[model samples]
Target: MRNNGAVHGAFRSAAMRFFSPRALAAPYVVWMAAFVVAPIVFVVIYAFTAGDGAFTVGNFAEMGRFVGVFARSFWLALISTAVCLALGYPAAYILARESGRVQRAAVVLIMLPMWMNFLLRTYAWMSILERNGLLNRLLGALGIAPLDIIYTPAAVVIGMVYNFLPFMVLPIYSVIAKIDRSLIEAAADLGAAPRAVFTRVIAPLSLPGVLSGVTMVFVPAVSTFVISKLLGGGKEILLGDLIEMQFRGAAYNPRLGSAISLVMMVIVIVFMYFMNRFGEGEEGVAIL
Candidate 1:
C-alpha cells in the first residue's frame, strides 16, 4: 500500500509540474494549432485532392495557364516595392534626423490614411485618379493637359506605393533612429565625407530594416486583389484575382485555388529565405 501511494504521489507531482506557470502557453499553442496549422493542412489536402476526393496533381498542372498572371503580379509588386524603397529610405533618413516633435507629426501624417478603412482609401484614390478627377482637374487649372493616369498599371502601382510606403518608412526609421550616433561621429572624425559616412556607416547599419520593409511591401503587393480590381479596372488579372475567382466567382474551383495559394506561399517562403540568406548576419531584425 505504501508503494502504491508513492506511485500516485509521483504521478501527481508530474502533473503539477506539467501544469505550472509556463503552461500558460497552452491556450496560445491550441489557438495556433486550430487556426494557423490546421488551415495550412487543409489547404495542402484540398490542393492535392479532386472534387471526387482522389489525390491528383492536376491542380498544379493548371497553373501553367496563369503564366502571364504570375509574371504581371511579380512585375507590379517589384515596381511598387522598388518605388517604396526609393521614396521611403529618404523619408525615413530625414525623419530620423528631425526633432522629436517633427518626427511625431510626420509619423502621424504618414499613418493618417491607414486609420481610415482600407477600401475607403482605395476608393478615394479612384476618385483622385479618375479621368475628370482631382488630379486632372488640378492639371487643367494649371493649363497642362490632363494625363492618362487612371485605370492603368500605373494606377495600380500608385495605389500600392501610397498604401505600403508607410511600412517601408517605419521599419527603416526604427533602425536608423536606433543606430549609435557615436559611429557616425567616429566616421566624421576620421575625415569621411558626409556622403561617404552615409554610404559606409549608416546605410549598412540600416540594411536589416530595409530588408524587413522589402518583405512587408512585396508580400502584400504581390497578392493584392482589391487594388488590382478597383485600380486596374478589372483588366489587370493578377495571381490574387485569379485565385479569388477560382474560389468565389463562377469558376468555383477550391482545389485549384488551394493549389495556387500553396504555390504562392512556397514562392514567398523561398523569397524570404533568399532575403534572410543575403542578410544572414543581421537575422535578428531582417526577418521581421
Candidate 2:
C-alpha cells in the first residue's frame, strides 16, 4: 500500500511539474503545433497530391519551365541584400560611434517611415518615381531631364532597400555597440593601426550580426511578391510572383504553389544552416 501511494505521489509530482507556470513554453508549443506545424504538414500534403488526391511528381517536374523566374528572383534579391549591406554597414558603424543623443535621433529618423502603412509607403514611392513626380519635378526645376524609374527593376530594388535597410542596420549596430571598449583600447595600446584595429578586432567580433542581418534581408527579399508586383510592374516575373500566381492569380494551382514554397523553404533552411556554421566558426576564431 505504501509503495502504491509513493508511486501515485511521484506521478502526480511529475505531472504538476510539466503543468507548472514555470513551464511557460507549454502553451507556445501547443500553439505552434496547431498553427505552424499543422499548416506546414498541409502544405507538404498539397505539394505531393493532385486535384483528385492522387500523388504525383509532375508539380516538381513542371518547375523546369520557371528557371528564368527563379534566376531573376535570386539575382534581384541578391542585389537588394548587397545594397542594404553596403549602405547599412557604414550607417551602423557611424551610428555606433556617435553620442547617445545623436544615436537616438538618428535611429528615430531611420525608423520613422516604418511606422507608416507599408502599402502607403509604396504608393508614396510610386508617386515619387513617376515621370511627373516630385523627384522629376525637382530635376525639371534644375533644367535636368526627367529620368524613367517607376515600374522598373531599379525601383523594386529601391523599395526593398528602403524597407529592409533598418533590419540590417539595427542588428549590426546592436552588436557593434556592445563590443568591449577595453579590447579596442588594448589594440590601440599595442600600436595597432586604426584600420588594423577595425579589421582584426571589431570586424571579426561583429560578424554574427552581419550574418543575422543578411539572413533577415535576403529571406524576405527573395520571397517578396508585392515589391515585384508593384515596382517591377509584373514584367520581371520572379519566383515569388510565380508562387503567388499559382494560388491567388488566374493560374489557381495550389499544388504547384505548395511545391515552390516547400522548395524555397528548404533552400532557406540550408542557407541559414551554413550561415550559422560560419558564425560559429568566426566566434571560435574570435575566442582564440
Candidate 3:
C-alpha cells in the first residue's frame, strides 16, 4: 500500500509539472532562441570579426563604398510601399463593403497570384514586358508604338508593387471589415458627409492596418534581390544585391556582408520604432 501511494504521488507530481504554464511556454521559448536570438547573435559575431579571426570594423568602413546602393534600395522600397498603399486602400475599402461571395473571390484572386513560384511570376513579366513580347505584339496589333519597359528601374518598381500589393490590401481589409457598422451609422447620424465620416472615423481606425501593411511591404521590398536582378537586369545594384555580392560574388567577404545585414536590420528597426511611435498618438489618422 505504501509503495502504491508513493507511485501515485510521483505520477501526480509529474503531471503537475507537465501541466504548468512554464511548461507550455517552453516550446515557444526554445523556438525563439533557436530562430530569432541565435541568428542575430551569429550575425553580430560574424559582423564584428575578420576572416583571420580578429575583431575589426573595416567591414563597415568598406560598406561606405556602397552608399549609392543603399540609397537606391531605400528609394525604391519607399516608392513601392507608397504605390501599394494608394492602390490597396481603395480596393480594400471596396472589398470590406462587398458581399461574402465577392469578398472571398477578391481574397482568392489576391492570394492566387502568390501560390505560383515567385521566380516564375517575376519571369512571366519578362515575357510580357520584353520587346516583341505579348505586350509589344498587342500594341503592334492596335497600331500603337511598342514601348521599352523591361530591364529598367521602372520594371523593377512594377515588380515590387505587383508582388507586395496584397500585403498592403489584406491588413487594411481585415481592419475595415471588423469596424462596427454602428460607428459608421453614428457618424452618419451626426449629419456628417461621406468625406467627413471617412476623415473622422474610418481613416483613423484604419491607420494601424496601414502602418502594418507598410512595414510588411517595405521590409521585403527593400531586401529584394531577385526582383531587381531580373527586372533591372543587374544594371542597377540595390543594397540587397550589394549584400549578396559581398558573400557570393567575387568579393567573397562574409564579414562585410554581415555588417551590411546588421546595418540594414538596424535601419529597419529604427524606422519601425519611429513609425510605431508616431502611430501611438490618439489622433492617429485624425486630420486636424
Candidate 4:
C-alpha cells in the first residue's frame, strides 16, 4: 500500500506541474493587461463619450471622415506591403542560400539601418528627394532636369518601402532557411519545371513567413505618422495625422480620436483574418 501511495504521489506531482497555472505566465498576463488591455479599454470608453459634458453619438456620427482616412491608410499600406514583398523575396532567397559568412554580412547590412532613429531615416529620404538634393545634383550633372520626388504620394510609398523592407526580408529568410533541400531536389527529379516547383512547393511552404512579414509591414505602414508627415507633407494627410490633429489641436476631442483608433483596429483585425484564411489549407509544403 505504501509503494502504491508513493507511485500515486509521484504521478500527482508530475500532473500538477503540467496542469497548474504557470508563475511565468502571470507576469506576462499582468504586463499585457497594463500596457495593451488597459489602453484599449480607455480608448473604448472615450470613444463612446463626447467632447461635451454629456454622452453623445456625435463622435460616431462623424465617422465618415474617419472612414475616408481609413481608406487612404489602407491603400498606402497595401502598396507598401506589395513593394516589400516584391523586393524582399529575392533578397531573402539570396541571404538564405548564401554561405554562413555572406549570410551574416547580409543580415548585418540589412539590419544596420534599423540602428538609426526612424525619424532620422525619414529625414534622410527627405533630403535625398528634395528638389535641390543630391539626386537632383546628379541629374543636373547628367544634363537632366531635377524631378520632384519629395512631398508626394510616390515619395511616401518609396519611404515606407525602404524603411519596412528589412521587416519583410528577415521573416522570409527565417522561413526559407528552415526548408529542406531534398524536398526541392525531389521536385526537380520528378520533372517539375522551375516555375511549377516554386508555385507548388516554395510558395506554400514560405506562406507563414510571408504572412508574418505582411502583417509586420502592413500594420505599421498604415498607422505611421512620421513617414507621411516627412515624405507626403501636409498635402497628403493620413489617418494617423487626423488622429494626431484631434488630440493636439484646440479640439482636444478624445472621443473622436478614440472612435477613429477603434475603427483602425477593426480594419487591421479584419485584414489579418482574411489573409490567414487565404493561406490556411496549404501550409507545411516543401520550400527549399
Please list the residue runs of candidate 4 whose C-alpha ends up more than 4 Å from where it truly belongs after superposition.
Answer: 1-21, 24-27, 52-55, 282-288
**lDDT tens digits, residues 86-197, model 1?**
9999999999999999999999999898899889989999999999999999999999999887889999999999999999999999899988999999999999999999
Candidate 1: pairs in clash: none
Candidate whose lDDT is highest: 1
Model 3, total clashes: 0
TM-score order, best first, reads 3, 1, 2, 4
Report the C-alpha lDDT of model 2 over 1-288, residue by residue, as the tens digit: 999999999999999998888787878999999999999998899999988999998788888898888888889889999999999988898899999999999889988988998888888888899889999999999999999998899999998998889889988887888789999999999999999999989998889778988988999999988887887788988888899999896899999999988988998899888888888865532210
Local distance difference test, each candidate:
0.93, 0.88, 0.90, 0.87
lDDT of 2 at 216: 89
Candidate with the larger lDDT of 1 and 3: 1
For each candidate, what TM-score against the reference?
Answer: 0.91, 0.89, 0.92, 0.87
The residue pairs that clash in candidate 3, if any, are none
Give the per-residue lDDT of model 3 (tens digit) for 114-141: 9998999999988888998899999999
Off by over 4 Å in 3: 19-31, 281-288
Best by TM-score: 3
Q: Per the 3 Å backbone cut-off, how many clashing residue pairs does candidate 1 have?
A: 0
Q: What TM-score would candidate 2 get against the native? A: 0.89
Total clashing residue pairs per candidate? 0, 0, 0, 0
Candidate 1 regions exceeding 4 Å error are 1-21, 286-288
